[model samples]
Target: MRYWPIPLLLVALFSAQGANAEPIGFVKTLQGGNAVIRALDDSERPAAIGGELNVGDTIRTDRRASLGLTLKDDTIMSVGPDTELTLEEYLFEPARGDLKLGSRLGRGTLQYVSGSIARLQPDAVSVKTPTGTIGVRGTQFVVRVGR
Candidate 1:
């Protein structure tokens, strides 16, 4: 009876829902012996200790903080003190895997060790900072971001 109105309503509903959708993934681990995770989203402010983590969710630490995360393909990454790292992208499949890690750095350090999957697909892993970008080449290194 009213096809135009129905289509417009459907589009608006879908767009609204999409706006609140959260990205999906898992939290491998929380290291440093005294680190805690805090959710920044409202849909589910779940505790993220070795649990699943989604987009729009932020993991934060106290004065003493550290974290070791194993991505979908077992890629290991360790973050240290007064730092904030966001899991921008985490994609893993049989044929290929891609991970984009972005860190505000704030005032701390981060050490990363690329996993076997990264060796096969070096382009799959990347870290972004205010200074520049760090591309993984199957090597281990530390990144410090601060004044």
Candidate 2:
């Protein structure tokens, strides 16, 4: 009976850890087919409208599938069919002037729009592909990575 409190404490600790895994963005739109999201430490799941996405998550869209996402800083991203993109890193705290965004697109196409993070610190945003990295300068751009 004395050990009962121990399990409760453990559960609380685990729950707190899970709570710290904040959502970095959400699925704003989708078309053609379903998109899948693989969390940093979780299995793949269907990305539905309004579904939350966290840092380190990988979003994959199959043929004829597309996805649109809006991040915490209002940065907009659209993934075209057969695309693989990862939210490698992100930190947005305007008050503290701490803003950073980094992502990698392995294949397919991506459309990006600048947001508060880019407006706050233009040099803090980067999108990488097999060839090289693209530095965002408070602008909108599209990229396609060939398979």
Candidate 3:
């Protein structure tokens, strides 16, 4: 007799969850168990294959660790050991023609492969480092940052 309340409650719950729990990408490859994911609040978790990644998340790899991530728009990114890369922003909506990907590499090496976002809107993708910023133009590239 209370079916109406159940439906309304479910909608509210799912809406609230999706607003903040939507994962932007996932961890695809992990060479070692020394990788960590740091949240905006500074909390960290061990990086593992299939782990969810969100915007503003920082991925850190120890001396023996490496990680690979695949974004929602099929963009691929891999980082070598001792790397600190943060996903500064991500917005992908091809139908509406709104796409962007921004990342920051603090140190170490990173390999990036362009995705639909870069292909459709080449000017929307960028990678920032300590010394400079890189604009993606539907291609793959590697960058290293040193202290």
Candidate 4:
């Protein structure tokens, strides 16, 4: 047998799977059905318990809404009412020494609880806001942006 066809087949398979790759996180809890997820493509969808979350997703909550979520690295976070946040980056591959989690909160409140990445590499986790970036060094922390 020849190896010529293997590369083409592998490329085809990976390209097909790329669009439906696993989510980075999910909506573990939601309140008042007021949270919406705006994708990088600008498509919006209502947030639901267990809803899958992806990188570049802008999570927004109305004045009466709040929600909680968990990432692939076991990181937990919750957002308060009128929140607008973006999941900017994430990479969890401990065996190969790749671990990072980053986000940007434009407004409202954010409560973040560090995960294995912080324990392994404290400098890998951060939450950026209008004022400054919160370098996650502890187990838990909270931040409030604009309002």
Candidate 5:
């Protein structure tokens, strides 16, 4: 019984730690219709405004839906309808100047605006599409991926 409690306690501790981990970004805005979100290790759900978006979360907009996301480093992304975007990975530790952002866009339009991560580490940001990867600088740009 003692050993069983110990294992249960450890599991609880780890589960609590993961639950307290910070999210990578948030859904700042949504327009037209609902957006679906597939979490890293969870099933798909409807995305709500102000919902936290974790790393590895995939977002999809329906026919006329649009979404705006604000990342931890303040990077802004606007996703158009009929688009699929995934937050592959993101690390933002400004204290040591360590910042990285990687994402993939599957079929739709996206408008990206640089943030502290890009301004501090210009080469650490990348957005991949079906064709190629985008090299992001400290600027805003638009990209579209085709089916």
Candidate 6:
């Protein structure tokens, strides 16, 4: 009887922990120009300005618009005007010092600055675009997307 109660308690505790754990990080900042920015979750709908961005969030920009994001590792990514991008994946594990970054670039320009995590494990960071993919190596660069 004691053993049964112990197992049941453990199960309940784990279930509760899983349910309350946040999926991923939240949007720290969002800036839009003449174009627009949309966070497809909740009823907020797509607006021509700024809003919260979460994991799996997608942003579309029209004529002359820009957006910037500060990731969990304090890495900065800025998108140029008339572009669309998605936050495909953003994960970090301080325990093992592992980090991963993935995004889908529809059409636009992106500038990425490697964060501390990149310095720690440069091989683990990657960026994906329509044409191909990019692997970071302690370097800062710009990417432009076109038809």
TM-score of each: 0.62, 0.85, 0.86, 0.84, 0.84, 0.69
Question: After superposing candidate 6, which stretches have Cα over 4 Å from the reference?
Answer: 1-50
Instruction: Tell me, by TM-score, which candidate is best.
Output: 3
In terms of TM-score, how similar is model 5 to the real structure?
0.84
What value does the lDDT take at residue 48 in candidate 6? 33
Candidate 1 has an lDDT of 0.59
Cα RMSD of all models vs. native, in order, equals 8.9, 6.2, 4.5, 6.0, 6.4, 8.0
lDDT of 2: 0.89
lDDT by residue (1-147, candidate 6, tens digit) is 455686457656764675422333333444555444444453334533234456666767667666676666767777877877777766666675556766677888888887766777887777778888888775588999997
True-vs-predicted CA distance for residue 131, candidate 1, Å:
0.9
What residue runs in model 3 are displaced by over 4 Å at the alpha carbon?
1-20
What is the Å distance of residue 86 in model 2 from its true position?
A: 0.4
Taken over the whole model, the C-alpha lDDT of each candidate is 0.59, 0.89, 0.90, 0.87, 0.88, 0.65
- The ten-residue window of minimal lDDT in model 5 covers 14-23
Q: Name model 1 segments beyond 4 Å from true.
A: 1-48, 55-57, 96-107
- Which is superior by lDDT, 1 or 4? 4
What tens digits encode model 3's per-residue C-alpha lDDT throughout 27-142? 99999658999988899999999999988999999999999999989999999999999999898868768788999999999999989999899899999999999998968889
- Give the per-residue lDDT digits (tens) of candidate 2, residues 55-98: 99999998999999999899999999999999998998777687
lDDT at residue 141 of model 5 (Cα atoms): 94
RMSD (Cα, Å) of candidate 1?
Answer: 8.9
Per-residue C-alpha lDDT of model 5 across residues 57-139, encoded as one tens digit per residue? 99999989999999978899999999999999788877757679999998899999989889998999999999999989868
Question: Between which residue pairs do clashes occur in model 1?
Answer: 23-55
Per-residue error for 3 in candidate 3, Å, reads 17
Look at candidate 4 and tell me the lDDT of residue 5: 85
The candidate with the higher TM-score, 2 or 6, is 2
lDDT score at residue 81, model 5, on the 0-100 scale: 91
Tens digit of lDDT per residue, candidate 4, span 27-136?
A: 99998649899999999999999898988999999999999999988899999999998998888778879888889999999998888888899999899988889899
